[model samples]
Target: MTATDNSTVRDADALRADMVRALHDQDAITSEPVAAAFAVVPRHRFAPEAPLDLAYDLHSTVPVKKDENGLNLSVMSAAHLQAVMLEQADIKPGMKVLEIGSGGYNAALIQELVGNDGVVTTVDIDRDVVDRARRCLDDAGYGQVKTVLADAEAGVPDDAPYDRIIVTAAAWDIPPSWIKELTGNGRLVVPLTVRGTTRSIAFDRDGEGLISRSYRLARFVPMQGEGAAKERKALLRDGVVVQTDDERVPLNTKALNQALDTPRREFWSGAAYDLPDELELYLTLHLSSAARLHASKEIVDSGFVETSALLGVPALVSEDSIAYRTRRENEDTGGFESGVVAHGPQAEALADEYLKLLRRWAENHRCRGAATIRFLPGPAPSTLPENSVLKRHGIVAVSWH
Candidate 1:
């Protein structure tokens, strides 16, 4: 090869090595197989339009496609997240794998894990994405990874009984077909959206339902086609909004906005706050009336809302009152202390309810992976279980042990 070509190859190899090391340090790459896959995959080839540095960045996603309104339709997920999910999958050599969302780089990594004897099939609802992934896989010498253009909601039935199925997009629920298509002992790793928050959960088959082995905080583009989320969003003002998938949660936009006009009330839980992901999972599930509260930087800067709302925090909403979690550094605790901010006439009641949950979590389930999630597919029961979220296809029941 020419000197210029040799230099480019060396640069890509260096970046890949750095990314693997960072992922390992963060505990995202916990297995040798996963580390090897990340080290070998030429991630930059999948997103040729992006800079090489961006392709190898550990925390940033490379956008692949956008919609008419300039929203990302698909993106190459960050390397750290990919490594986390792969480790969660625990794919072994000669294992047949099905990827719900098509991204050439991830599929290539899967190919490396599965080896020559294994089969890899990737499906995407968008034809453009399928075409792009197909070309990228071929260019990267991963043509053995099959590409299919179809809505992943139905799954690729022709290749049923996959040992492992990894979904890249944010799924609202686990469909019946996915469970049926997997082998009896297979594992399905999906970024499932429960209420308004999403978590990447690793589930193993259990009878007609699925049970989680582990879950971690994750964010991804929403799934398209038949299984799209049915969540509702009400814009309270220019850059403030509340979103919820639960039908029981009230979305009184006018009343909520008016409640914001009143003075804000703050309630301190007097409990140590850490392990935010675990805390959030408990709060979102246990809150009687829950939704996600979001505010823009402009509103936060104006002192109308705290920075917690900037990224959408779990909120307790009543007819005319709202309360959400906030944090303050506690010198004694050596970290942060959880608190509540409420508004409207029933602010006291809402804040009391929210504060109770915060303190309960801190007292009982403050550690990571304390909650176990189970997806029971079929018709909903007359009385929904406590800490359960209903979906079109199943009920997501979460319990702390």
Candidate 2:
């Protein structure tokens, strides 16, 4: 219990070292301190039930707990994402860090970054997760790390003024408490979901508002409790789905489903298709009515939908029609060119709208991290700014250069 079970000790060490090397190779671990922390955390110990290969897998998450519906309630986030966030945090020795979700492995890594003088606390709303994390932390020689069983929405008041607050879950909005709890210059790295896409954004306080320093494409389990997302979902038959958080976007499942029966229309933007993440953010924010279209492989294979929706693609949705991004390799461009696929009675109108956005992104803001995301905490203004999403706590405003 003191170190990894001796039986797997050698294997775990070698796996851990290999994992660190792979993180560096992938550019997930940039600084020496984060690399050192990953090098020693004994990740396999936290997920003892998982296979060593899976536990140390760089891009895979080791599931910790799931609900009766088979949805993940908690997971050991992918090591690659963890490293990226830690680097974004830039944790210094003797700095205090509060991890919003409890997972022994991440807390252990944070402990290493903070060193002897720094304090680390992990909180979870579920008692079972807290108890399990406490047990794992103790077994892994991270007893110094504190485990609290409480809803993380309130930001662990007893340990006020954290140097860094890192949320492992995907949040719909930045609560006022999280910003209030940060030290004057403290940073918060959270996976914030906007429109329908989620990005891990590093936010620093700018007066009473929060401005993003950087944002990376990330996927994580949605937060539970007070900060849970209030998304509207529509099932347009067996394998096709559409969802959005913007209350203004209409989701008429029956009408949209019928639109699928109409002949499909395709339009090319004449713009190069690359840096999909950046393009997606721009489209999601700039679209007048944005939603996400998702399709199972079966649907895509049946020639009913494009492969872009297999994971989820930004869609411009109207009352009875939908237009989502698609791409095809073009010899002239030397790569893929952005295009649109529209369905329903308004297919032409929707496709024209979608194509314009695609061309605009390629011409003006088609680069990594081109969008500037800002969160202003307070009541909504009488007239909200353009490209602004309203949340319970604040309005998220995004702009492009």
Instruction: State TM-scores per candidate.
Output: 0.98, 0.98
Clashing pairs in 2: none
Clashes of each: 0, 0
lDDT of each: 0.93, 0.92
Q: Compared with the true structure, what per-residue lDDT tens digits does model 2 show for residues 1-401?
A: 54556658988899999999999999999999999999989998899889999999998998888999999999989999999999999899999999998888999999999999999999898898899899899998999999999888877999989999999999998888899989999999999998878889999988898899999989999899988999899999999999998889999999999998889999998999999988888888788899999999999999899999999999999999999999999997599999999999999999999999999888888778778889999998899898788888989998887
- For model 1, how does the per-residue alpha-carbon lDDT over 1-401 read when each residue is reduced to its tens digit? 99988987899999999999999999999999999999888999998999889999999999989999999999999998999999999999999999999989999999999999999999999999999999999999999999999998888999899999999999998888899999999999999998788899999998999999999999999999999999888899888999998898999999999999899999999998888888888899899999999999999999899899998999999989899999999988589999999999999999999999999899988877898999999998898999888889879998888
Q: Residue 47 of candidate 2: its Cα lDDT?
A: 92
The lDDT of model 2 is: 0.92
Residue 25 alpha-carbon offset, candidate 1, angstroms? 1.4
